[model samples]
Target: MTDKRDFAHIETWVFDLDNTLYPHHVNLWQQVDARIGDFVATYLKVTPDEAFKIQKDYYRRYGTTMRGMMTEHGVRADDYLKYVHAIDHSPLEPNPAMGAAIERLPGRKLILTNGSCEHASNVLARLGIADHFEAVFDIIAAELEPKPSPQTYRRFLDLHNVDPTKAAMFEDLARNLVVPHDLGMTTVLVVPDGVKDVVREDWELEGRDAGHVDHVTDDLTGFLQGLLAKG
Candidate 1:
C-alpha cells in the first residue's frame, strides 16, 4: 500500500474508466474489444483471423487500434467511436462502496479514458459513480490520440488546467501511466483481482516493471477505502 503522504498533495483524481473504476472481472470491456475486432474485419475487408492480428498489431503500434486505423486507413474517428461504444453495459454492477469512497476524497474527480465519453459515461453510470466525477476527458477530447502519448496527456492537462504535481492518476494499464508519471502525477496501477491470466492478456500485463508505476492494487474498492483511511 502507498502511504497517504504520497498522495497528500493531490487535488484532482484522474481515473481510467474501464478497469480502474469498475472491476475488470465485470468483463464489460470484452464487449467493446469484440466490437473493435468486428470493426476491423468489416472495414478492412479482412478475414476475422487477419483482423485479429491487425487489431493487436495496430493497438501495439499506435497505443490504440482506432488511432492506427485512422492513420493507415483514414477511418472516421466518430464512426469508429460510435460503433465500438454501442454495446450492452449491463455487465457492470454498481459499486456504491467504491463510489462513496471516491466521493469522500478531497477535490474534484475526473475520468481520463482511452475510450469514448459516451462509453465512459455508460460505465460510470453502471458502476454508480458518474456523479462523483466532475468531467471526462475521452479519446475524442484527446483528438483520437490515446494515453501514453505525451501530447495527449499535455492536451488533457491544458484542457482541464490541472497541475500534474497536484494530481493523481489511476489506470489499469501500466503503459498509460507513463506520461502522467513523467509529468509528476502520482500513478497507481490498478490490477485485476484473482487469476489475471484468465482475464487479461500477456501484453497488457507486461509493463508493471518499467519503473513508472507508483502504486498498485487489485482491489479498487478496498484501495480507495484504504486511501480514505490513510488520510
Candidate 2:
C-alpha cells in the first residue's frame, strides 16, 4: 500500500484503460503481447524471439510498441491497432459495482489510454462501464504520443479542457503517473491484490517512496467506493 491522500477537490476522473480498469490476473495483455510480437516479426522478418525483444525495447523507449513501429518503420497506426486489439475480451467480467461507484463520483469521468480508442471501447463495454465515461482520450487522440510524455498529457488536457488541479489520474504503471502528479492531478497506482511475490515488468516497477504517487490500491471499485464514501 502507498500513502493515501485527499481527493475531494478532484472533479475530472482520468483512468487508464488496461490493467488499471481490469485486474492484472486476467492476463488479457498476454494475448495482445503475442499479437504485437507477431506483428513485429512479420514486419521485420525476424524470429518470434527477436521480435519479442524488439517489442519490449520499443515499449521501453517509446512508451508503446506501436509508436516505435511508426517511428522506425512508418507502420500505419490504424493497421497496427486493428491487428493488436483483435483478441477476445471475454476475460473481463462486467463490473456493475465499479460502474455504480463511478456514477456516484462528482463531475466528469474520462479514459486516457496509450491504446487505441477502439480497444478502450471494447474493454469498457466488456466491463459494462462504457457509458460511465464522458470521453476517451486514446493514442490517436494524442497524435501517437503516449502517457508519461508531457506532450501527450498536455494534448489531452487541451482537447478535453480538463483542469489538472481538479483532476485525479488512475493508472496501473507508476511511471505513467509522474507527469500527471507534476501537472497537479492526484495520482493513484492500481496493483494486483494479495500478491506478495508478483512479477512486474521493468516499466511497471517503481520505488514506493516516489513522491509522484499519492495512493495505491488493488481494488479499483472499492477504492472509488471509499472515495465516494468520504464525500
lDDT of 1: 0.87
Model 1: per-residue lDDT, tens digit, 139-188? 98998889879999999999999999999999999988888988899989
Please report how far candidate 1 places residue 160 from its true position, in Å: 0.9
List candidate 1 stretches off by more than 4 Å. 1-5, 195-198
Candidate 2 error regions (>4 Å): 1-5, 195-200
Error of 1 at 21 (Å): 0.7
State each model's CA lDDT, in order: 0.87, 0.89
Residue 119 of candidate 1: its Cα lDDT? 85
Backbone collisions counted per model: 0, 0
Could you tell me which 10 consecutive residues in candidate 2 have the lowest summed lDDT? 194-203
Worst 10 residues of 1 by lDDT: 192-201
Which candidate has the top score in lDDT? 2
